[model samples]
Target: MFLVGLTGGIATGKSTVSCMVKDMGVPVVDADLIARQIVEPGRRAWKKIREVFGDEVFLDSGEIDRPKLGAIVFSDIEKRRALNKITHPDIYSEIRGQVFKHFLRGEQFVVLDLPLLYESNRVSSYLYKTIVVSCDDELQLERLLERNQFTEKEAIARIEAQMPLDRKCQLADIIIENSGSIAETRKQVEGIIKLLRSSNHHIYNRVFYGGIFIVVLTAIAMLMYWIFMR
Candidate 1:
């Protein structure tokens, strides 16, 4: 099965692209969803987190208080790393398990939607192709502030915690520029899905998508050559 890794920084429209990809019939496994599941009440990850961070991070209803915890962890790199140490392995295992299930169930293509693909150092090892949904900083900041009701400072802090978009774009195999309208973004995703439905994830597929204009001209050349020879 072809596995495509999808990732981006906070509020960069990665989820939007994932939705579009899902609409195109490609199966998607969300690492963020799995991470949240692993840390829900009664889960081992939840127990470990509570044991380390105490009940202070939980609500009276017994659920994790994400914003409270984020306030703590995001302010300190050590605490952030500590939280990562607790959650990352469990999150990774669940993501891998789900991806394997999809493969076993005979999916032609599967997408691994991750928020920290590069930060976790899993991109080069697990997937040959990574799609980074990128938008301008202004757009990203605007979206984050609007969606989360966060102040600009608060949104900037969250955005800065992740790898910079420039670095992510450099590391990615392909990028879907999301600064434009939703229709524009969906158009890009649609084109990508149509191209991927046919084959495995290899260097050839990479070149086909990455060098699309050149590949198109080459295809036309080959077609003309065949017609003339005939």
Candidate 2:
């Protein structure tokens, strides 16, 4: 399957575009959802977090106190990297598993909805293309403040923590300008879906990988036969 990486700055409407793609019948492996899941109460990441950050970051019910953790990491770059180190491996593992499941089901393309697709670059090598959803910086700050109820300072800190939207757009194969109306964003998404569907890259990938598999099997068989003959 052709893997497309979808990313954007915080509050840049990346989620909106991701939903549009999903609603249009494309498979999306959501990294944010996977990140939440991997850090649940007793998961490996949860235990590591508990060990590293101590009991303060957890609630009485044993769930990670996400807001508390977010406050820490967003304010401190070291803390954020420490958190990423703990959770990223598990997140990527789950993402890969989901992508493989979709590929096995013969999906032509799958979108990986990642917030830090460029920052981490962990899965960039596997992507057939990348789409970055972006908007004006001021609008992004306003949306984040309203949606997250964070003070302007807190919101700006979180935004500054990420790679800039302009840089992301520069690296993107396709850029969806989300500074306009929802209708405009939807139109762009539709065009992107049409472009992806028309590419038919998945067929070529499958054939290429299948040929390699066959070649390996044939080589192993020939080696076994020669040993037996000897």
Candidate 1: deviation at residue 7, Å? 0.6
Tens-place lDDT digits, model 2, residues 105-205: 99999999999999999989989999999999999999999999999999999999999999999999999999999999999999999999999789889
Error of 2 at 7 (Å): 0.2
Off by over 4 Å in 2: 226-230
- Residue 50's lDDT within candidate 2 is 95
All candidates' TM-scores? 0.85, 0.96
- What is the alpha-carbon lDDT of model 2 when measured against the actual structure? 0.95
lDDT of model 1 at position 101: 91
Point to the candidate with the largest TM-score: 2
Please report the candidate that would top lDDT against the real structure: 2
Clashes of each: 0, 0
